[model samples]
Target chain A: MSHIHIDIRKKTYPARDGSGEHLAIRDLHFELAAGEFVCLVGPSGCGKTTLLNLIAGLDRHFEGSIRADEGAATLRIAYMFQNPRLLPWRTVRENIQLALPKGEGREWVDHLLEVMGLTASQNQYPQRLSLGMSRRVALVRAFAIRPSLLLMDEPLVSVDAPTARRIRQLLVRVWQERPHSVLFVTHDLREAIALADRLIFLSAPPTALLHEVTVDIPRGEREDETAVEAFRRRLIGEHQQIRDLL
Target chain B: MRSLLYHPISSFLLFLAFWQGLAVILASPALPAPQAVFQVLYQEIRSGNLPFHLGVTLARLAVSFVLAMSLGTAIGIFLGRHEKLDRFFDHWLVIFLNVPALVTVILCYVWFGLGEIAAIAAVVVNKLPNVVVILREGARTLDRDLLEMAEAYRFGRLKTLLHVIWPQLFPFLIGAARTGIALIWKIILLVELLGRSNGMGYQLHLFFQMFDVAGILAYTIAFVAVIQSIEALVLKPLDVRAKRWRR
Candidate 1:
């Protein structure tokens, strides 16, 4: 089972005002085996989100090329945004069903909604949901797709601390159930620590890859102490070094 | 429940009292008392022509409103789906929104030669832009994550729209429809007055020409009552039902 190899080399977007080019990704390169979980952390305005968009083929205007070696576009890629971004009018279940492949969508929608603890609120709309609940709905919506690649962009930014922990657990469980490559982007160092198998630290503006640290902390362990201490000393050092650059 | 009904009426009665009090102080007949207006309204009802005129006006308003709503919604959905198209037609919406309804009605009359189509067209032209703007804004704010999820799952375009986009846009569309109906009715009446021979606006003009203050007040009261009934019986219930998803 070969994995997706996204060779992103020298991507840039000309600044909107045309004064200068906003170099979003400069000479970026990365490869993930089929089931590896990757987390990308960066400073504010470091353009990790933009890079995610480019990789997803949502944005085609860039200086460089992205060659996807393994999965076809039909292999499917689920993306979760900073905000849950649930459709306000659709019931949470309907929102998930809307993401499923026609006839096969309903059962998965039901199952995933249950998995996300949204079965009770299945009939409720996005506006009626709390922040954590909304993000969970977003999670179920993304996870239900059975994507070859799961791309997450700071999806839990607004949830409470305790809720965030629970969500992190759910994410890991889903990852275990269907071992897909996940490109998780976050600003939270603790979050990048808790979830990622491979952590990539992105540099400040005119974003470029800085450090690639492989966290060997065993999964299914206590997320707080187990994940943190395993790579804490080295990860913290790299985190602070990148922090000073911004 | 009783207080809710009484509050607005009492407020209106108080306003009328102030106007009547000023009328008494100035000793003028130009501004009639509320009772006088009510009396005039009663007299118009007794005259037996009120119902026929009211019926005609209501019919005109219905046709105009429906035309404006469906067309505006269709155009809005298209504009919302296509950003390039939205930009191209955005200036047209600005022009329509700013143009006075009366001036637009006049132009319709000039172009269409005083037929019922002119009246209907005038109301539609005035009402369409408002609905379009509301729907376009709704379309722009649609959640992209949900859409990306839909794409990833490989839902057909029909399923995505039916289950995803339509459900999301329904509340916005319904609210726009409700408010647009309220606006379209008044504009339609104006169009009826300037161009069409029958309808509330035309009847109001007729009463004015004949110095029949009671008749004018009767029609005004009738239209106001109809609007309130529509709000209470139709739009309010629809809104409650639609917003249940949000709840």
Candidate 2:
């Protein structure tokens, strides 16, 4: 099945403080296919989040259109944010339950709990979990409902190095089997290269898509670090070039 | 031993001893010592009128406090969910917050014709706005990402409130309740003084009319003791419960 075409010909947000205006994104035309992992790479202040918000329908001011061809108008969309954003009041399992359609069975929640390695901590709330564990819970919360499109906004940035790699691996496995499209946003170029099939690089502030690069890597848990190293170097190279310009 | 234990009783005993020593050095029998006060308290208790009147006063105080807390929390939650509603009520809230409890109680008596309803109304009005302001600020200061996450997963408004909004609001509610509970007891006494019969404040007024300082002290002690019990038993549990969401 084909994923949606986001022909966001232009997107603009009016400046709240009357500082002229804010151009979050402009003329962004992209088509994502089913089972494709697309990453948006940008500087820290770039509008990757705004573009993700547009796709999520959390905001609707974009000039163009995004049409999902595969699902009905009510199909669920999952999102993982930079902060994990789990409710501190809710237990780890309950946060996943929030994603499910009402009256859905507990079995699906149980499965995700097991897969996310949160079974032991299922009764604990978000504040009790480490940053990496909370991020795992956040990932499971997004994937629990089997969304039509999963949107991730720098989901692993808060975790330590070893845990970030593990989470990156977990995300890839879920992406490989997601049965939907993923629009991943990150400022980390290496993260984009590691998980994305195609990477869209967004420049600073009033962000514009500078370039899109395609990555070809097979799936598996082979612990070879060379490709990851090479991808990191390439993204770092791009990062330096973008940094100089911005 | 647990978090709720109060340490001021021993300090209070020491303070009383120091007062007694000062009175002894000054050789003044006019200032009753702590021992004399305790003797008076024991004689009043043995006569059984103390417990009866104390229970009546405590019951009135409890009714007033419970009414204030439940109604205050409801008003607080309502103000929290509606921004324009909060703005419209802002001046009204400030008006009530700044009004002296004695003046508010007298006004309630005049307006509502000096009844139990007037007394409860006074307590409720006195306590409500602080809770509203506290929870309004709590709701306003809510983490933006948690809200976005709720929408992202498509949680319904009811679920969002119960799971997301309420937990964040609870700590503030507890804080408001702590302060409100304190304010509540004092306001209830004033309400009882201005309108009601058979309460600690009414007895205090009676003692004042007779110029009976010991009777006045006894009634004040009874009311303070009741408020202290509620604090140690009730509000402390709520405080712990609210903070439980953090870890």
Across A181-220, the per-residue lDDT of candidate 2 in tens digits comes to: 8899887766677777887777676677677778765544
- Ten residues in a row with the worst lDDT in model 1 chain B? B147-156
TM-score of each candidate? Answer: 0.78, 0.84
Using lDDT as the measure, the top candidate is 1
Q: Candidate 2: lDDT of A145?
A: 84
How would you encode candidate 1's per-residue C-alpha lDDT over B1-247 as one tens digit per residue? Answer: 8796579788887888897898678765555666788887777678866778778877887888788878888888889889999999889889989999999999999998898888788888998898888888888887777676565455668877886687678788888878887888788777877777777888888988988665677689888898889888988898888777555
lDDT of 1 by residue, A68-143 (tens): 4543644567889888766676778867766665566677677777788888999887888889999899899888
TM-score of chain B of each: 0.87, 0.85
TM-score of candidate 1 versus the correct structure, residues matched by position: 0.78
DockQ for each candidate? 0.37, 0.74
Query: For model 2, what is the alpha-carbon lDDT of residue A226?
Result: 78
* Span of ten consecutive residues with least summed lDDT in model 1 chain A: A66-75
Query: Considering every candidate listed, which one attains the maximal DockQ?
Result: 2
Residue A218 local lDDT, model 1: 69
> Candidate 2 docking: what grade?
medium
